[model samples]
Target chain A: QQPVQSPQAVILREGEDAVINCSSSKALYSVHWYRQKHGEAPVFLMILLKGGEQKGHDKISASFNEKKQQSSLYLTASQLSYSGTYFCGTEPGDYKLSFGAGTTVTVRA
Target chain B: NAGVTQTPKFRILKIGQSMTLQCAQDMNHNYMYWYRQDPGMGLKLIYYSVGAGITDKGEVPNGYNVSRSTTEDFPLRLELAAPSQTSVYFCASRGTGGSGEYYEQYFGPGTRLTVT
Candidate 1:
């Protein structure tokens, strides 16, 4: 089944912070995060494996909780370029990925 | 490496018409997938291939077929298209490894198909 993402949409100002959460009904072997700007393909951000690892890049970071079957993306000091739709794809230890409906984030100056 | 490429960026089809959406990756990835996204919705997998000659069905594979004749190509075919099949199709490929937990995928520009 498709994972559930909270906060269908959010608006933020530059340098602000925001969080997007994804929860799955089934156990997830991994969680992949991506960002897609308007009219563009989704861009890979980071992937959290089963160990409940956390990863970060620039002002963006993500954490996976195996016990809860959930993952969270943390955007700190968000930038205007961060305005886009965020997608979380879950893999149930298989070759296929099931993506969430997505969360739209708009960052303004 | 042109990463992944898909043909016929946009298409319009009538009910019962048949067509194939082509996807190719120059990265020599071992896995390829086809997914469709409806308006304001996430992607749903239609088909996937683990390697050349090994194809499998995903969450939403009905009315679709796939072929992996080579490592660089995986195409999705639709027969007797219906209005419900109208959506933006995406083709993605990822290399092997990563403890099989997470494999970063590279997606093509996507094909916008409209079935009437």
Candidate 2:
């Protein structure tokens, strides 16, 4: 089944912070996060395995709670380049990923 | 090296028409996937291949077909296209593994198809 994402859309100013959440109806083995710009392909950010772990990049971080069947993406000190759609892909089983509807994030200068 | 490439950036088809979207990756990845993105919605997996000659259906695999004759090529086929199938199609590939036990996928530019 497809996952559900919260906050269909969000607007933020430079240096602001935002959180995008994705919840799955079924159990998940791993969660993958991606960012897509307009008219472009989605870029992989990070992946969290079952153990309810957390991963982070320069200013982007994500946490996966297998028991909760959900994951959250955190953007710290957002930059203009961070304006895009965030999608969380969940692997329930069979190594197949079901992605969420996505969260549209806009970061203004 | 060209990470991933897709053919026919845009296309139009009528009901019952058939077409093929070509996907190729030069990174020699072992995993490839096909997904469709509708307006205002997230991507829906149509099919995926773990390696050459091995293919499997994804969440929304109905009305579509795929072939993985080689590792570098994975093409999606639409037979008797319908208006509902109109969407942007993307192809992605992931190498064997990532440095930290994660697999990062690289996507193609995508093929936009409109059915009239």
Pick the DockQ winner: 1
Write one digit per residue (lDDT tens) for candidate 2, span B1-116.
Answer: 99999999999999999999999999989999999999988999899999999999988899999999999999999999999999999999987654445577899999999999
lDDT of 2 by residue, A29-82 (tens): 889999999899999999898898899999999999888998999999999999
Report DockQ per prediction, comma-separated: 0.88, 0.87
Tens digits of per-residue lDDT, candidate 1, A1-109, equal 9999988999999999999999999998899999988767889999899999999999999999999999999999999999999999998887678999999999999
Cα-based lDDT at residue A70, candidate 2: 86
Give the number of the best model, judged by lDDT.
1
Clashing pairs in 2: none
Question: For model 1, how does the per-residue alpha-carbon lDDT over B1-116 read when each residue is reduced to its tens digit?
Answer: 78999998999999999999999999989999999988888888899999999999998999999999999999999999999999999999998865544569999999999998
Q: What class would a CAPRI assessor give candidate 2's docking?
A: high
